[model samples]
Target: MDVIVIETPQLGDRSYLVHDGAVALVIDPQRDTDRVDAAAREAGVVITHVAETHLHNDYVTGGYDLARAHGAKYLVNAADPVKFDREPVTDGQVIQIGNFSVTVVATPGHTHTHLSYIASDGTTEAVFSGGSLLFGSVGRTDLVAASDTVGLTHDQYASARRLVHEAEHDAELFPTHGFGSFCSSGPATGAGSSTMGEQLTANHALTDADEEHFVRDLIANLTAYPSYYAHMAPANAQGPGPANLQVPESLDAAELTRRLADGEWVVDLRNRVAFSSNHLQGAVSFEYGNGSNFTTYLGWVLPWSDKLTLVGEHADVEDAIRDLSRIGIDSPDAAIGTEPHAVAPDAPVASYPRVGWEGLLEGRAADDVLLDTRRTDEYAASHLLGAVNVPLHEILSRTDEIPAGKVWVHCGSGYRAGVAASLLQRTGRDVVHVDANFDEAATAGVSMAELTV
Candidate 1:
């Protein structure tokens, strides 16, 4: 069997093309199906089967289109059947295509109707375990509400535990999401593939944690599933239809800065904590990880804009750039109808409106609420006095906890404060950010206490 894993880093998603003889199977495909079609053509193989482990919450799934285009049978979990044309895959069932065979095992922890496809090339076995289990953690159970929620029932979790036991100790496991992906809470790193044996022993959530504990930890750590999933999932399940989907253009740094100065949004796609610390003063933050599904999220949540800039982790810029391309969001040379804004050659970090103590005091005097959006531990160690604690990650769901008024957002530095400002601004709240810490204000002889909100 020839197995190729297609990594869609934008959505932190993975799809596989497995073939034997002249038959091929594509599992959990993302929105873009051009590559799969091309691969099949190059190999002179017919795509006979298109499989989806489950209806995803994090990104759109492309199983339906692959099936429709090639006259292949669409495969999904037998339990949660889609209305569209698809063949139901049952637990302990095996799909045979010439010499290739894949076993469908019901692994219901991540979602009630989820399944894990175990591919066997006559001898060796590899399991595409979807969101059931990941490298260091498991899929979150709280993404669904009542009827669709999975892994909460005792029977459901036990079934997951059983799936782990059923797989061979040496079977290669491929998960839907790992580190750095919005699916897991731990800092996304070193979260490569691992064997069932490795995960059973080294997986933090699996080892030294009970099934209930695992479920609780998964729920507790999940930041927030994308709000776009409510619609994107159905669209994907039915198939995204075509590749002609249009996405907006992205602005370069200078153009983005100019738009920000002109009262346009500069949505940063970095992590929550990093976004809070230092960002452009008037920027808004969505913090969608480097993935294609974020495209739909951006479309669903944000109003159509002529200009936008994507700020990502320095290391993630390329992947982030690629993901944005999947949805047709092109990077433009400049913002339309505006000149690029350039910072001075010798400008200090404190020179930005969101960076230093001087701006912090002025922002406070503007009757803006001083918000310290950092982790509780980070807030405890040291922070600007009189700044209320409101971590950026919790700002969305905990919006009511924040006092209503003009807001001044800040963090240990200025990144997270930018995120807070962006989120707050998106919700129609006026906000400003300081350039630096309180010490910078004190050094500049600014009275932070006197500038009361």
Candidate 2:
């Protein structure tokens, strides 16, 4: 059997293509199908099945569209309340593809309808434990609802133990959530694919722990997930459209001005440094960088109904659109790659002052504001004494709450602080970007506080 892992680093999710010469199966695919198709073509096999472990809460699944396009059977949990037609699967149900077999194992925790698929040839075996039985930790159980947290945590423990007990002793485990994903309950202990044997000894949920302790730890560790998560479940339930790679038309200065005046979203997709140096007055920064979670921030801040205009290079704009489409944002109204001067020669340009951590400490004054753009839990763990906790995702909505003056923004690292500074500056607030390591706050003699829950 040949197994190919397709990773979407930004979403921290993986899709697998498993085949045995003639037929293949795709598990937990993202909205972009080009890679999957390419993989299938390279393998010289026809895709006969596409399966989703659950209704994804993080990004839109391309399973349905891929299945329809390839005329393959689309599989989902039988219990999920999906609006589209699918081959509903139950526990222990096995589907034969060429010389391989995929058996469904009901593992509900990440969601009520979650399933883990075990694929095996006559010899070796592997399990695609989507969101269950992760490398070291398990999937976050609180995404469904606050009240269901405890119950889901209990289910998570049971499900993880089941994978360890029922699957083959040496079954290679591949999970969809981990590697810096917000959907993970905690950080994974190891890297790459792990076996059930390794997990039974190392995975937190698989270790000998009581249900209460596991639930408590799971709930306590969940950081702030993206606000765009609210739109994913419903959209996935109804089945989102196929991926659209078409770039929007380039808007000239006149058209861009009209959109800005009409309150449309003007997102600058350049690097934070370029965006900070000079950008259109109203455009906000959603930098296209390796460290930037482009979709998460853009989806969190942009209203569902607002028309978006991407401003960046052609390649960058296309890449941004492709990433945005993963979360069910198929296309923007317009995109422009022209030089800033040529596109908006007469328009006003704005910038925010970027300062290092040392500068912030040396120039500290009583009247200045220090903003912490990390998650609430991170802020509570350890933060500068006087820093106000306003996560970068919520900065656009909480502009009125910020005190008037020079706001100094910093996150765990500098990436988020740059994004926050741009938003603050765009809103006409005097802002200073504290682009430095937050760990140095204590060394700089800044007062620190740790909140106890």
Candidate 2 lowest-lDDT run of ten? 333-342
Q: Model 2 over residues 1-453: C-alpha lDDT tens digits?
A: 989999898888889999998899999999999999999999899999999988999999999999999999999998999999999999999998889999999998998889999998979889999988899989989899999988988999999988777789898998988866777886586487789998888888978577788788778778888888888999999988898888877887888877766656788888777777788888888888676888877887667667788898888888888998998887785556645676777677788777777788788689899999998988887999889989988887888888888899999878889888888887778888888888887887777876667
lDDT of candidate 1 over 308-370, digit per residue (tens): 555544434444444544443445222221111222112111112344665555446644577
Please report, in order, the local distance difference test score of every candidate based on alpha carbons. Answer: 0.62, 0.85
> Residue 30: error of model 2 in Å?
0.6
Model 1 residue 216 CA deviation (Å) reads 4.2
Q: Best candidate, TM-score-wise?
A: 2
